[model samples]
Target: MKLFRSKQANSLTELVKACQKQDHQAQVQLYERYKGRLMGICLRYARTEAEAEDIFQEGILKIFDRIGDLKKPESVDSWVKTVMIRYAIDYYNQVTKGQKQLISTDYIETEWESDDYQNLFSKLHTEVLLETINELPEGYRMVINLYFVDGYSHAEIAQLLGISEGTSRSQLLRGRNLLIKKLDLKGVKQHEKF
Candidate 1:
């Protein structure tokens, strides 16, 4: 499939093939296609726009550098996201190395999966919710993103972040509590306890 200037790549198979061959235009097209989505993942992990841009650039490079390793073009969207998520975790690990953020072990009795909390959380504007979660402490933010947003299991999160499963659970709990409290402070919730 020729990446002609007048038209778009017609299929994922074609795009992946051209990208694997280092076709510049195809690479640009790939970049353009996933920029918003991949950058959203980066921004969710990063504390600032500058940091998100840095992560986004790094992820794109990885995507380009390893595009040939992608065996199935049909899964390109998910594969690209996986690449970005792994890179984000690596970035997190590097930043947090040897700097253990102290975490409070308060065990809040809350069914995080219950519909009540989900409805409560859903009430906030998307921007407000993301900003609130972003402002959480590093450990809290990382675990929350991994578990809540990315659908990673606690065990998977533990392996990814190089922490114990218990630590993952605690971090997620703490993060959730902190996020709820922050939401409360913002007048999103008046008498909610979790």
Candidate 2:
């Protein structure tokens, strides 16, 4: 039982130790605990649920393969997040095939400070939102997801998508307009209380 308890200094020591010893049950426990959050993270970058699931699985495999290289156990969450983000960027690169230019994110600020962000998301089913996003044209969908879903700035999105900052901004504007039209929310002011 003590072996199952991670060292106090190392947040991920228990999971890491279990994985190292090929403890399937421990691995399953870890997966169950983190699956939802990681999926949410992956969903922002993936164009579809199928793709997001694939990314999630790949990210877990990456964790398994690279956990041994982690010098600090407590940093497990951050480490996993880094791997996931990198995987998404790589996937985007592979899928887009050099269509986007990497842009910067120094000036993009989000206005979603109200609790409404959570409430709005709760009211809007994930599947519906995803379907709507999937319906967007390739470039618009990617920019919108990266900016709003993944919390990347226009600059970061431009860089990630290999487009100019202006292009990223334009795509985001276009994506939002398309979404409003699709969802029938045209003429509504930005930040209007739902």
Badly placed stretches (over 4 Å) of model 2 are: 1-13, 16-26, 69-72, 96-123, 185-194
**lDDT of model number 1:** 0.81
- Segments in model 1 whose C-alpha atoms lie over 4 Å from true places: 1-10, 100-119, 187-194
Summarize candidate 1's per-residue lDDT along 1-194 as a digit string, tens digits.
11122233358679889999999999998898889888989989987888899999998999999999999776777788889989988988887545777555544765556665666666667787788888888889989998988888999999988999999998888898988777656534533422
User: How many times do residue backbones clash in model 1?
Assistant: 0
| Candidate number with greatest TM-score | 1
Residue pairs with clashing backbones, model 2: 100-161, 100-162, 100-163, 101-162, 101-163, 102-159, 102-162, 103-158, 103-159, 104-155
In order of appearance, the predictions have TM-scores of 0.83, 0.62
| lDDT tens digits, residue span 1-194, model 2 | 12123345353677767766778887787677667777776876677788888888888888778767877666666666667777766776787545653332322333445763445444555566766676676677778877776567887877776789998888787677666455433113222544
Clashes of each: 0, 10
TM-score of the candidate numbered 1? Answer: 0.83
TM-score of 2: 0.62
Q: What lDDT score goes with residue 183 in model 2? A: 43
